[model samples]
Target chain A: MTLFFVVTLNGLTLAALYFLAASGFSLIFGLMRTVNMAHGALLLFGGYVGWSVVDATGLWALGVMAGGLAAALAGALVQIGVLGRMQGDELRQTLASIAISIILADLMLWIWGGTTYQVRTPSWLTGGTRIEVLGIGYATVRLYLMVFALSVGVGLWLFIQKTRIGAVIRAGVDDQDMLRALGYPINRIFVLVFAMGGMLAGMAGVIAGSALSIAPGTDLQFLLSSLVVVIVGGMGSVGGAALGALLIGLAEQYGLAYAPTYAAVVTFVIMVFVLAVRPQGLLGRAEA
Target chain B: MGTEALLRLSNINLHYGSSHVLHDVSLELSDRPLGILGRNGVGKTSICNAIFGLEPITSGTIMLGDQDLSKLTPEKRAQAGLGYVPQGRRIFRSLTVEEHLRILERKGGNWTTERVYQTFPRLKERRRNLGDRLSGGEQQMLAISRALLLNPQVLVLDEPTEGLAPAIVTDVVELINQVAQEGTSVLLVEQNLHAALAAVQDVAIIVGGEVVERVTAEALENDPKMQKQHLGLEAAGA
Candidate 1:
């Protein structure tokens, strides 16, 4: 029972990180249909940058902001330089993004020296608190991560539902040309969304890096996990990303506990199962 | 009628990968609604598309008021007081009727969301319904309402009544006439001659992508032979 509670807590915390990384991937892919193969690189890049900042300044929040901003800038450059010119050619976009990921990975190696680095958790989140109800203790940072993920989810949902720009985003997701015709500058919207996605990826990287080791090629794993999350959650949906993260996180935890060797493959199995049953995903609108 | 046309297209030429579609097509819209009449393949919709900056013209100029619109983007053209209801309605399938209006709502316009709801009471009833869930007529209504809420200096509609039933057609035509009467200059492109005649003050007939005839709507209404010559519409009880 204690083992179950501990695993559940760990799974939920991991789910939070997955939600952060996958939400941006899903948003960018769902809105523009651009496969950002470089997303994982961005995540690692953010983590490295965040670690550097915290090492220099000893300020964790500043590290998080710096990481997010760095990734946002990188995302904007990628969109304008590579993805924007592809003109709906998926093959070209995919190839371009993969090239970007490789280049970014090499840059990370050159800068960070191919060594795994962990960002120090803030003083407030360094310890664990015992929960009397569950008869277990969980790291305070893990609780913070879960709360942060929930806040982001709720905040994103509110923005997409209540704000004017959110309306334009939703409208553009349906018919981009019509949104343009309505006098809302869609290119600007696209840039904003891409940047936001990058920021989220970066933010996720910083938070996850503090909790776990971030190193070379770590992005590929995170990217793969995000792919599963999006596929299972439904593409282009905020709610879908959360659900998908939860499912993948729980499945991974269970798999790791029972059959440690095959834990990585479990996410794929879940993805294949979901795809076989509902191709559009759990919350995706049926393609007409 | 005046020296300055509100919306002017001069010697416009459009091409689709070297296939010339619009050839030296010129049009002037003033206070009165101008109905563009043409059969399919005659580039009637192309004219509207060009005016809205949807398709780039190979050569020519489009003037909206004092601004030269040929170089501007579609959104810029819209900001310059141009409203367009493109062919196929092009409604955002996921947005609600209220969201459709709310997304494009601008301040200081006589056309507000409440005003649009009052104009199309049925739209008010389906305010929360997604664009895809509405009937064809209701979709058309939402499209027009969205454009109207922009309070454009000129409204361009391309075949808005194409697939609507007869009863809904009357309602749509009535709404078009009402919009025009409320002092918004209208450019209506239609293949239906009767609706065109009823909705506009002037007629510009295009055949094979060139303006073959330009006359008053009343003149086209009175002359059956001219309508037969250009529109190929047979006379009554022929």
Candidate 2:
């Protein structure tokens, strides 16, 4: 029973990280329809930046913030300097982004080398805390990460649902031409959204580094997980991303714990099932 | 007619690939509403698209007031006081009726969200419903209301009454008049001859992608011979 409880908590923590990574991916896909194949590269870059910041400044929060900002700048540049020119050409955009991801991965490897780097947590988050009710000690950083992810989820939901800019974004999702006809500078909005998606991915990278460790191939791993989560949850939906993450995360952990040999196939099976049943995704609207 | 031209298209020519779509199309809109009347496939919507910069004109210029709008993009043209309610009432399906008004609502503008709701009470009733859920009449009202929220100097409506019932058609014609009376110059494009004649003061007839004639609505109404020759319609009273 104790092992099951611990594993469930572990699944939740992992799900939180996946949510942070996939939310940005989903947002970019929802509005721009760009596959953004380089999302995992951005996450790895952010993680590396966070590690360096923490190594130099010894401030964990500052490292997280710096990592997010760096990734955001890179994301905006990608949109303006490359993706913007290929607007409306999805195949070219996807191919271009894939090339970009490869280049970014190589560049990051050259700068940071092959060594694994773990972001040093603050003293408060360094150890585990005993929960009296659960009668177990859980890693403090992982707990905080789950809470942080929850806060970000709520905040993002509010931004999309309640604010005026959010309303414009929703409208744009419905009809880009009409929104432009209403005098909106859509290109600028596209850049802003890309930056925002990058920020979330970057922050998730730092959190992932603090909780585990980041290396070169970490980018590909997170990228695959993000793709699966968004595909299962529904493209372009934040709620869908969260739900997808939770299901995938829990399934992976449970599979690893009980059926070790089949652990790798668990997430894939869920995705295949979802695609067969609902091609638009669980929460996604059918194509109009 | 003497109130100064608000929107002018001069010698405008457009071609899609090698085929020409509009040829030397010219128009002048003043204080009184101007209606472009044509049969199907006469390139009326193309003119609106050109004015909004959706399609680049092959040659000539579109002028909004004294400012040249030929070089601007669609969004920039809209910013320069050209509000368009496109054909088929292209409302955002994901956006609710209230969201449509809220996003475009400008502070200190003549058309406020409150004013729009008051003007079209049915829209207020359907405020929480998604745009696609509204009836055709309600969708048309929402489309018109959103354009008015821009407080534009000129409002261009393309087939505002298409696919609507007769009673709703009457309401749309009346709404066009009200918009014109509120000091916004109207550019109405329609195939419904009666509705166009009822709503606008001046009319430009298009045939084979060219402006055949520009005449007062009253003159066209009385001259059945010209009506049949151009519009293929009997006299208004007949």
Candidate 3:
């Protein structure tokens, strides 16, 4: 019973991480129709920057803020420098972003070296106390991650539904040409959406690196997990991503607890099954 | 010029790369319903776009109430008293009818949510419906409502009654007339010559982007040869 609680808690933590990463990926793809391969690299880059800052200054929130701001800056630059010019070609965007990912990864290697390094957790989350859930004692930090993730989901839902710019974004995703005809600056909306997505991914990376420890090739791992979440959730869908992350996170935890060997394999199978059955995903709206 | 003419297009030409789409298209308008009629692909829509600066004229100028629109962006032109209801009822699918009205609202105007609802009461009923979910006629009403909220002096509607039910087309014509009655100049572009004749007083026929014939409906009714040569439609106003 205790083991069950532990696995479910682990699953929730994973879901929280997946939610942070996938929401931004889904949003960017939803409106811009651009698959940003550099998303993974940007995330790792954010983690390293945060870790380095915290290493130097010994300040936790400042590190997170600096890391997030830097990643957003990189995202803005990429949109202006590369994706802005490569409009109308999907293959070109994918290839260019992949090249950027490779370049950023190498750049990180030169700056921080190839050795795996652990991000120091803030003193607030340094120790865990007992918590009772379903008649089982569990670690407290993991519980906090679960709560934080749930809050992020709710906050994002409210943000997208309530704000004025959010209304424009929703309209833009439905039909960009129509938005342009209605006198909204569609390109500017795209920039704002992309920047927000990048920032969220950066924040997610920071939390995940602090919690689970970050390393070389961590970008690829984050990318793989996010991709799976997106596939399960459906592309261009935030609600779909959130639900998918939770399901996959729990599934992964149970798989890890029982099978151990089929940890990734179980989630992969579920994703494939969900995709083959409902091409648009469980909670996804139709693309058209 | 203030009270005499609301829209003045002079010697406007448009080209898409090497292909010329509009050639020396010129027209003058007052606060009256003006009809621009031509067969398919005669550059009637292109003329509307040029007048609203959606397409930059390679040559010539468009003056809307003393504001030059030759190089202005589409949104800028919209702000400069040029309201265009583009073809295909380009409504934002995600936005509800209310939200559509909210985005196009301008300050200091007779055009308001109340006025729009007064014009088309059906829209007030479907205020919560998304633009896409509406029927063809409802979409038309929403599109026109959005433009009206801009308080434009000149309203350019491209095929306002296309693919609509006969009854709805009547409603659309009545709405256009209402706007004209409110002292807004209407530029009606249509392939339905019969419907166009009922809606406006003046007609300009463009053949290959050049205004081959510009005349009043009474004069057009008298000239059968002009109709046969340019539009190939029988003059029925007589």
Query: How high is the TM-score of chain A in each model?
Result: 0.97, 0.98, 0.95
Q: Which stretches of candidate 2 lie above 4 Å from their native place?
A: A1-3, A130-137, B1-4, B11-24, B39-42, B58-60, B207-213, B222-238
Docking class of 3: acceptable
**Superposed Cα RMSD, model 3:** 4.1
Candidate 3 chain A, poorest ten consecutive residues by summed lDDT: A132-141
Say which docking band candidate 1 falls in: medium
Instruction: Report the TM-score of candidate 2, chain B only.
Output: 0.97
User: What's model 2's lDDT at A138?
Assistant: 95
TM-score of each: 0.88, 0.90, 0.82
Q: How close is chain A of candidate 1 to the true chain A, as a TM-score? A: 0.97
Q: What is the TM-score of chain A in candidate 2?
A: 0.98
Model 1: per-residue Cα lDDT over B112-141, one tens digit each: 998888888999999999899999999999
> Could you say which candidate leads in lDDT?
2
Docking class of 2: medium
lDDT of 1 by residue, A165-264 (tens): 8878888777776777778877788788889999999989999898777989789988988998999999888999999999999889988987899998
